[model samples]
Target: MPLILFNKPFQVLCQFSPQEGRQSLADYLSIPGIYPAGRLDADSEGLMLLTDDGALQHKIAHPDHKEAKTYLVQVDGIPDAASLARLQAPIDLGDFVTKPCRAVRIAEPEWLWPRNPPIRTRADKPTGWIAITLEEGKNRQVRRMTAAVGLPTLRLVRSSIGPFSLATHPLMPGEFVEIPVAALKSKR
Candidate 1:
């Protein structure tokens, strides 16, 4: 199996096709036949897995598979105990209710790379970091979850997916590394 772990940069579209004014996966990866197992919105950044094998892609991306994805988020305000509890519990996102997941405050990761064109800062407001792990992903779910609890997400980075982590296999934005299929044995 051909599998690639890519650190997607902010504002890069997740698809392989060309977009008129936006950067897409085609801009960085020339490997043919490999498709993104899942997607990260243009505004978000972080780890993405690509594979040529359809079954592998499904196993990684499908919600039913329950592979945990961890994200490091910078939000506009410091969350108190109530907010943290709310985040870890099932909460209705209007269209659907999120599954209970782990959510905790964290200091900014030392190994994080700076985002290009950085997020805005204000003298009047404070920002805080939180690490959230979710088993099921929804479109803009992290941003929504934070907003629902009165903390607006300013930066979002998916730091890890299942056994593959940026900490263990680090890559700068637009860089990717291929690992053997055996690396996935832990998941089985």
Candidate 2:
């Protein structure tokens, strides 16, 4: 079994588990034997990894592996350099200090599609985007980190994991593509 890289669209659940009238991996992925290596919450969207190799799945999803995951986050407030630096710097998240990461302000991305159940818009407020990369993925880590810095996330998208990039292998909502196992293990 190889890997299937997916650009999971918004409002899509990351598992095969059925919910009452809810979308799940079963709806998008028809490839048998493959399962999501990790998960993207229904409200969040972006790169999702699917594979049948249990060892490879563990390598990608294990927090201890420190595999870098990158996200493009739209936040309710514009962040200044100091705030961006704070995100790049480590902060004690109570349980642990996050591994040092990279956070930079970026222009609104043009490559994104309109999200289903779009993020709420405030008539009087503005939003901005930031690119953040983390080696450690905790539960809703990016969302929590942005909130911790006073800039709550309005939308979050995981753009890449290690060498896999969603931009290269685009997935319309409810579609999938497959990659051979050896190909997934190759250097980009």
Model 2: per-residue Cα lDDT over 76-102, one tens digit each: 999999989999999777777887999
lDDT, model 1, position 38: 91
Clashes, model 2: 1
- How high is the CA lDDT of each candidate model? 0.94, 0.85
Scored by TM-score, the top model is 1
- Model 2: CA > 4 A from native: none
**TM-score list, all predictions:** 0.98, 0.93
Best by lDDT: 1
